[model samples]
Target: RRQFLITRIYAPKAWWFGFCSSVYSIAGLWAGAALAIYAAMIEHKNVAVF
Candidate 1:
């Protein structure tokens, strides 16, 4: 949300709660369909949630 500058009020209209991660290699979704969410360390990196 920070990266996209999305507000809490905008969340319901902008994003959904049910969508989860998909394998890029296997799912083959569009470029704007997925967003990364960081887990632990910065080096460990984020998970793609669609």
Candidate 2:
């Protein structure tokens, strides 16, 4: 009974980790895209000012 309860508790934690991993990956992708766009905008602005 003790082992069963421990397993049940960890099962949800395992699922939570999986869900968090996907969310983290998606956020990382968006951050990368935003950085790229910002860099392009800076380059364009410099060109226009020069």
Candidate 3:
């Protein structure tokens, strides 16, 4: 009975870990894309100002 309970608790934890990792990966991708776009915009502005 104790073993079953432990397994049940761990099962959800494993799933949660996977879910969190996927979310983190997606967020990192979005941040990288935003940074690239911002860099491009700054470059364009600098050229225009000069």
Best by TM-score: 3
Q: How do the predictions measure up, each by TM-score?
A: 0.16, 0.63, 0.66
User: What do the candidate models score in CA lDDT, each in turn?
Assistant: 0.42, 0.81, 0.81
What are the per-residue Cα lDDT tens digits for candidate 3 across 1-50? 99867866879887678789999999999999997888787987666433
How close to the true structure is residue 41 of candidate 3, measured as C-alpha lDDT?
79
Order the candidate numbers by lDDT, best to worst: 3, 2, 1
| Native-to-model Cα distance after best TM-score fit, residue 23 in candidate 3, in Å | 0.4
- Single out the weakest 10-residue window by summed lDDT for candidate 2: 41-50
**What is the overall TM-score of model 3 with all chains considered together?**
0.66
Candidate 2, 4-45: lDDT as tens digits = 678668798876787899999999999999977887879876
Superposed Cα deviation of residue 4, candidate 2 (Å) = 18
At residue 15, candidate 3 shows an lDDT of: 65
Q: How many Å off is the CA of 41 in candidate 3?
A: 0.3
| Candidate 1 positional error at 37, Å | 28
Clashes of each: 0, 0, 0
RMSD of each: 14.8, 6.9, 6.8
